[model samples]
Target: MWVDRADWNCCGEPFRIGSQVTWELRRDIDVRWLMEALGSDTAVSVDAFQYHHGDTDVASEQTSGTVARIRAVHWRSAPQTGTVPGSGVLTELNEADRGAPDRGDLTFEGFLVTLKQ
Candidate 1:
């Protein structure tokens, strides 16, 4: 196979930065949904970025510097499973020099806790 480079989405999908939202796992969900529905949370590690995309919010390329942002859900406190000791990354975005789109995965332990709300 070719040794592909660059993350699945590069710098991250575009976004307006300010208009963003986030969610956490509840204790009443199922791991199956986290797996079958959106894609296997196992195919990739929760630590590794997953998928991403973006587009311009303007009618034309009038604003060249106009940039937005994309987000990902990385499980810091992943499962207390066989994973290495202390795998908590804490998911939070910070002000950036123009953040980009990105994707991510969750470890098995994370998968269990994320949806098992």
Candidate 2:
């Protein structure tokens, strides 16, 4: 799942910014759907960045980009278990430079992306 500040058209109705959109990772390289959601038709770059130690401890660094800031929201399956699954979120974007958001009880790893015409 991903929450973005853009409209998405991959799953029938368009999901606007802040809407959680779910997408399956295919072979870990299929990102066409995500690019489309960001309203891009050309090439885009996606890079992975780590910003947290676990579900409780957090440490983030500042980053800038031309497209989107992809952050991973990680959480545990149960209260007694450790951190497990993760989802992505689209944060500050389009030439904006910012640091990772505060993840109080969840882990956030992120990516800095750029779009090309």
Candidate 3:
């Protein structure tokens, strides 16, 4: 689920594929709350960023590197109307995320994240 509430704030245009970066949560609340309210099902995108692809009982987008099973999430809300998680699971796992080749600290400007895919 992608956060899209009128009260909620979004950073900027979505990045492209192969762009490695880190992003922080905009709100303090869990996205599951919004997901349950909007989405009927959920699943994480295989991409490291977890780009939303809508609800599905079976995994969608079988293309290699495009389908990662995000444990047990079943989002039913539409991307244009769902809530995005505030956590940074994707960047945390990939130790070689943005930042430097050694340190993994990320820099942020408002909500913009810079990284290397």
Q: Best lDDT goes to which candidate?
A: 2
lDDT of 3 by residue, 9-101 (tens): 233233333433343222223434533332423222121222233344534332122212112112223357443343222222212112222
For residues 7-64, what per-residue lDDT tens digits would candidate 1 score against the true structure? 3224433333453422211122233323332344442322222222223341211112
Where does candidate 1 have its weakest 10-residue lDDT segment? 108-117
Best-fitting candidate, scored by TM-score: 2
Off by over 4 Å in 1: 1-17, 20-85, 96-117
Q: What is the C-alpha lDDT of each candidate?
A: 0.27, 0.32, 0.27
**lDDT string, candidate 2, 20-72, tens digits:** 43332111244454453333322144332222222333333333223323332
Ranking by TM-score: 2, 3, 1
Question: Candidate 3: lDDT of 9?
Answer: 25
Instruction: Indicate whether candidate 1 or candidate 2 has the larger lDDT.
Output: 2
RMSD of every prediction? 13.7, 14.5, 15.5
Q: Which model, 1 or 3, shows the larger TM-score?
A: 3
Backbone atom clashes (below 3 Å) for every candidate: 22, 0, 16
